[model samples]
Target: MRVLVAGATGVVGRALLPLLTSVGHEVTALSRTPRQGTVVADALDRSALHRAVREAAPDAVVHLLTAIPAEVNPRRLARDFALTNRLRTEGTRNLYEAARDAGATKVVAQGLAYAYDPEGEGPATEDAPLWRRPPRQFAPVLAALRELEERTTDAGGTVLRLGHLYGPGSSYAADGSFVRQVRAGKVPLVGGGGSVFSFTHAHDAATAVVAALDKPHTGPLNIVDDTPVPLRDWLPELARMLDAPAPKAAPAVLARMAVGGWGVAFMSKLRGADNARARLSLDWRPRYPVWREGFAAELNGTSDGTQG
Candidate 1:
């Protein structure tokens, strides 16, 4: 199979190219900037993307475009995710349309697993409703995600709803912003930290994309790990791993003032996602089934932090 991968320089994309090749698939990288043999085009730019996709003439298309900032401000969550939101919404539409026009048989695009409503339950399944009424700063982000998923599914594509990514080139890396904040004791447990978190390594995410191409699955699939841990459980351990002070507890009201309503909800009200459908449908399993091993390997220098 010939595959065209957008966001080819991203964390997951960097890892995906090699894996696709290893499995006997020829891959073409689509990028905004010039590279050795990459199809140079920005996903947001429809004409350029159409030309690039037509030129690649792939059998499958993988949309992994995102522009999340390294240092995100919780108080300004929407502002931080503005460009990424566009990538999910407008960028997704352009890519899917282009893929169809180019005669791509399969499309695999990215989605979020942790964006489910916080109403109830253990871990959210793929069918669970997204947050209908979220914090002010998070509304647009959710709207964009919904649009991405709807558009991809309309094109008969698969949407891999990945969990909180934490690996090399991710925000949770040893040298990442999250780690820096944890080291400085800036990340706190808000409202007892009841919210659950499902994590995914960048490599695992890349492999899932490969599986999506081979499988007959369409619509949204939750691609996450086995364990769904809470902030109260993971935060302290992460701090210890970094040899940093334990995270302190903050009252919900105070945290709301400090990081805004979205931050509070993220820490205390967010729900984790279940990956049973993905496991059964794709015959896929996360290499690092739990956050503990993956985190330790990445932070302790045992791993180079690349998805590969």
Candidate 2:
């Protein structure tokens, strides 16, 4: 297969590019910055992106562009997400156009699993309705996701709804801001710490993206791990592994005051995703099946070298 990968320098993209080539697929990587063998173009520029993909004439295109800032002011996620929301909505359209112009038959676009409504229980499947009615703050993100999903599916492509991304180059990484905050006892366990999350290591997520390219689909597929753990469970364990100070519990009111309402919602209400569809259809499973063990492996800088 001949493939075109946008955002080739991103966390998952970095991993996916090599994985694609190792599997014997001809890969055309796109990056804003010039690199050997990578097509240079602004992913949001429809004309430039189209020209790049057309020249490559790829059979598939993977859209992985995101503009999340390095330094996160938790109080400002709504503000911080503005650019990334545009990337998701506008950039996705541009990439889809590029793929279409290039005559690519398969497209695997990036999506979020945590955008589902938090009212229900258990892990959310692709059928769950996204948080459409909102305080308007989170509406942009949800709207972008909805647009991206619909556009990809309408174009006869697949959407990969990924879990909270971890592993290297992410905020949850060993030397990341979140780890530092935990070590300094800055991140508090809000209320009962009830929010559930399914995590994805960058490598595993990359593997899933590659798997999605191989599988034919026109719907959203959750690409998450087997275990769905709550914040209260993982935070303490992560602290323990980092030898960091244990997080202090904050009442709902106080936690909201500390991290803002959105942060609190993330800690106390967000639900996890179920990856059964990806598992069966893609014939793939996470390399790190559970995050508890995965955290140690990532933090300790060790790998079992298996795409578990």
Candidate 3:
């Protein structure tokens, strides 16, 4: 199959290019700066996106645009994610429209598994309602996610609701801000830290995308590791792996003040996702079935912190 990937320079996109090539698929990466045989387009710019897609004439289009902050500070993180929200909402529309015009039948886009309703027990399944009334300010984030998924499915595309990505080139990477902050004892354990989080190795995530490529999917599918652990369990282990001080505990009052309402809610309410659907539908399993191995490999320098 011929695939056109926007955001080719992003964490997952960088890894996906080679993955598709290795599988004998012809892949074209859309970049701001065009190179030999690559498509050039900014995903936010609808006209350019459509033109590039039309020119590439791919059978499938992959949307991987993101604008996460370089620094991990709360202010910067909030500001940067707003940009990502736009990418998920507006940027997604552009991709879908472009893909349709380009005669592409399948559009594979990224979504987050952590956005599901926090009320559910264990890992949230694909059918679980996303936080419709998220903690005040968090509504837009989840709303954007829903919009992206709806747009993708409306176009007869597949949405991969990936878990929190780790491994190399991600927030958990050696040089990533999360590691730097944790080493500095800046990230705190909030309100007992019971909130669960699913994780995915970036390499495994790219492989999942490949698996979904040929599969017939029209709705959201969770792509996560086998284990879904809580912050209390993973947080301290991550700190230990970094050889850093354990995260300080914060009471509800202080936690809300420190990271704001949404931050507190994220650490206290966000639930993990169940990947049963992805495993069955995509015929795939994570390379790192547990985040422990993946995190340890990246932190301990076993994984080169490249790829995704």
Candidate 4:
């Protein structure tokens, strides 16, 4: 397969390139800035993206474009995700059209698994409705996600709705911003930490993209691990792994004052995702099936953290 990966330098994208090659696929990286083997073109730039896609002449195109910041403030969540929202909305449209024009047979794009409405009982399935009345800052983010998924699936493509990504180069990394906050006792467990989280290692996420390329599955597939843990469970465990002070508990009302409504919802109301459909459809399984083992390996330096 001749594959072109947009946002090739990103955390998951970096992990994906080498995996695709190991499985005997010709990979072309598309980036905004010039890299040795990458075709330079901003995803938001429609004309440039079309020209780049045409030049690559890929059989498949993977849309992993994002502009996420390293240190995200929950108070400014929407502002932080503004560019990423555009990538998911406008960028997806450009990529879909470009892929069609370039004669690509497959299109695989990234999505979020934790965007489901918080009123559910168990882990959210692929069909669960997105947050109907999200926090003011988060509403636009969900709108963009809906747009991305609809556009990709309407084009007969696959959307990998990944979970809270944790590994090298991700927010949960040892040196990452989230970890830094945890270490400084800045992140608190809010309202008994009831929100459940489903995690996906960057490497596992990359492999799922490879599987999507080889499989016949389309539409959204939750690419998460076997275990779904509540914030109270994972936060303390992550603190132990980092040798940091355990996160302190805070009332939801007070937390809202500090981290904003989005932060409180993130720590108290978010739902985890189920990966069963992805497992069956793509015949895929996560190497680190739970966050405990994955976090240990990543922080202990047993797992390779280098970007391609």
lDDT of 2 by residue, 241-290 (tens): 88889888889898777677777788888889999988998898898899
Q: Give the clashing residue pairs of candidate 4, or none.
A: none
Residue 192 of model 4 has an lDDT of 92
TM-score of model 1 vs. true structure: 0.97
Tens digits of per-residue lDDT, candidate 4, 137-202, equal 899999999999999989899999999998889888878888888999888899999999999999
Every candidate's lDDT:
0.90, 0.83, 0.84, 0.91
Off by over 4 Å in 4: 305-308
On a 0 to 100 scale, what is the lDDT of residue 13 in model 3? 79
C-alpha TM-scores of all predictions:
0.97, 0.95, 0.95, 0.98
Give the top-scoring candidate (lDDT): 4
lDDT, candidate 1, equals 0.90
Error in Å for residue 168 of model 1: 0.7
* Candidate ranking (lDDT, best to worst): 4, 1, 3, 2
Q: How well is each residue in 1-308 modelled by candidate 3, as lDDT tens digits?
A: 99998777777776788889888999998888969759888888999988988999999988888887666444234454788889999999888888888889888888899988888888999989888677766766677788888998888888889898876677788988889989999888888998898998778778888888999988889989999999999999999888999999988678776677788887788899999999899899887898899888878788642343
lDDT string, candidate 1, 173-283, tens digits = 888888899999989999999999999988899999999999888799998999999999999999998989999999999899889999999999999999999999999
Clashing pairs in 2: 286-308, 287-308
Candidate 1's error at 123, in angstroms?
0.7
